[model samples]
Target chain A: MRNLIDILDLTTSEIDELVAVANDIIESPQKYAHKCAGKKLATLFFEPSTRTRLSFEAAMYELGGNVLGFSEAQSSSSAKGESVADTVKVVGYYADIIAMRHPKEGAPLVASMNAGIPVINAGDGGHNHPTQTLTDLLTINREKGRFDNLTVGFCGDLKFGRTVHSLIGALSRYKNVKFVLISPKELTLPEYIIKEVIEKNNIEFVETTNLEEVMGQLDILYMTRVQRERFFNEQDYIRLKDSYILTPEKLENAKEDMCILHPLPRVNEIAVAVDNDKRAKYFEQAKNGKYIRMALILKLLEVE
Target chain B: MTISPIENGIVLDHITAGKGMELYKALGLAELDCLVAVINNAYSIKMPGGRKDIIKIDAEIELNLDIIGYFDPGITVNVIKNGVNTKLPKIDPPKEIKNLIKCKNPRCITSVEQELPHIFKLTDSENKVYRCIYCESKAK
Candidate 1:
């Protein structure tokens, strides 16, 4: 009956529980391997994805469940003019749960409404990715050991970064969390998000074009890609692409304990040399994505 | 000149002037074969500049109050039965609306999946803001 359409769909307590379970899974991987012995997971990705789709597959496989469905829309019945509701209804018969990623923002929501089984939104356009938010939460928990009283700096593509928006939504639920939004004016966080989540929640936040000025104050630095696909003109994309590249020189000003995070497949936004830094937790964050997804699948399936 | 009072139908009163046609279209009034009266720029004692819109449907038809509230929450509804004003239902806008206002975001899934219904949820009641449930685009 439950679906992971948005990060807010899960309560703070539920998120904490997911993190707790994820931590346990990390510590004792074998103990919970075959929890969903006979369950099936359908990954209905309408768009091509490497990490998000694979993470879901790996999570389900580790849970002793089988995976089905398509990696692209062309491969699915969608190419034959099948509606999302119809596709979901048909898929619900074959799978115990569904993880769908679509180019359209609310396609998963449409599926969730019609699906008989629990639906997990792997990624829905740039609208929401709750599982990624959970993964980010787990990364923060593991790296920093706490959530409250932390200054999180969101750099680059704050406007179009769904992960940034999602993480900000999640982090705002905690106490004493301040946001340092670093981006060009064109890519600044959307006004509705500002009015709805930040200002409405009374969370302290500062907006600036300079990432270096606010680098030292941050406990968590969340980086996002300024997508080339989002731009109509190549000149604008090229001009603003290198605006906030996090290099060793920039990292020098940040706190030693400051955790660097990114929803990966990052382009030149992050310097290759900075990957060696202990603070860069994106790879580990990617790995943690599987565990949290495992925790999510198990929780949704109600498999003990 | 005063318009004749309705006897056995729903009276939608106090709609903002120049918005009655929109409400009529939204409510699919064009499909209605029954007698329907729309008084545009009607005199209003309470409103500033004494202007409002009044719709008198001369039949007892099922109306979705939530949709009415969303279209124009300031409007008042009066249910008339057998030449009598029977009840005035509370017109609070719904928190969640399914298959209604579409998400305006170009990147929204509904845009591609043309068969999908446009869904919205009332995110900010004070601001009277309804956002696309899919992409969270604020309704215009």
Candidate 2:
């Protein structure tokens, strides 16, 4: 009956359990191959996405589940003006679970309310991406072997980056976690996030325009692309697009073990030259998304 | 400068000074043919600096108490019967608001569908922040 709409919907213990299950799936892929046998996953992607959609489809296939639904609104009855609430109610009858990615934030939330089955928000505008948060958690847990006492640096856009907001909210639950927010003045972390998550939670955090100065201090460098889609003004996006481009030269000051992550479909934010670097783990992070999603599908389906 | 009391109607007392007109508009007092007196700045001991807004409507219309409460907690609704305050209904703040305020998020489905109700869930009551249930956008 529960849906993964926001990262905060999952508690600390629940998140740990999910991470544990994800690790288990990674350890023994064959054991969970048929865990979701005969179940159906309706991926109602109203927006164009490659990684998130593929990850869900691939995860379901690995779990021995069937996949259904449209890739975009144009392909579905939505193009003819069928409402999301009505569409989900009908789809809920066909699918055991739904993984939806909509350009409009809260579309999945409306589905969760109307649908008979569990609804997963793959990505919702710039609001929240819980599954990505789960993927990030699994990646962090595997790479660092811990969440507590880590200096996490978030580079580039934080104001409109839902991943940064979700990850910061997730990590704030752990102990001794300090955040180093690196972005231009326009793209700096929102004051609401600073007030609600950082100040209210009493988590230590510092804001800066420089990423290199604090590179050595971080255990994890969470990189974010300046999202052109989230911005209302193309000029503003163009002006701030190259705010932080992670090159090998930028890694000179970073610690040897500091892992870098991006919810991919990355632009020029992270240089291709850094891909070979031992510290770069964004691709690995993307791969982890499938495993975590597999675990999430299992949890929501009660296949575990 | 006292407005005459109504014999059989409702009186909204102790609204936050500048917010009376907003509530008035939200409650749709425009279409009503009844005598609606809006006191934009009225003296009250309860409010800070002894100033508040009051609304007196000469009709027994059902009030959207939840919206009123969510809009401003200090507002009290008094029902007058036979020139006396016969009842004081408690306005419980609505935990979830549906279609009252539009989700301003351009990327919200509510913005596109146009037919979908603008739903908001009260996330933080103490800070009085309501988030759009659909897009998670904070209510302005």
Report clashes for each candidate as comma-separated counts.
2, 1
At residue A163, what lDDT does model 2 achieve?
Answer: 94
Q: Which 10 successive residues of model 1 chain B have the least lDDT summed? A: B96-105
DockQ of 1: 0.79
Cα displacement (angstroms), candidate 1, residue B66, comes to: 2.7
Candidate 1 per-residue C-alpha lDDT over A1-304 given as tens digits, one digit per residue, 9 for 90 to 100 = 7889999999999988989999999999898888988889999999999999999999999888899989999999999988899999999999999999998888888889899999999998878999999999999999988888999999999988889999999999989999999997778999978988999899999999888899999999999877777777888888877778898998878999999999899888899899999999999999999999999998898877
CA lDDT of each prediction against the hidden true structure: 0.89, 0.90
Q: Which stretches of candidate 1 lie over 4 Å from their true place?
A: A228-240, B32-34, B80-90, B98-100
Q: What is the per-residue lDDT of model 2 for residues B60-114, given as tens digits with 9 covering 90 to 100?
A: 8988787897887768888888888965666667899888888888888888888
Report the lDDT of model 1 for residue A136.
97
- Looking at candidate 2 chain A, the ten consecutive residues that score lowest on lDDT are A236-245
lDDT of 1 by residue, B4-121 (tens): 8777888888889878888887888878898998889998997767999888898889887778888877788889987888657667888988766766788887777776668788
Give residue B54's error in model 2 in angstroms.
Answer: 2.9
lDDT, candidate 2, A68-142, per-residue tens: 988988999889989999999999899999999988878888889899899999898878899999999999999
lDDT of 2: 0.90
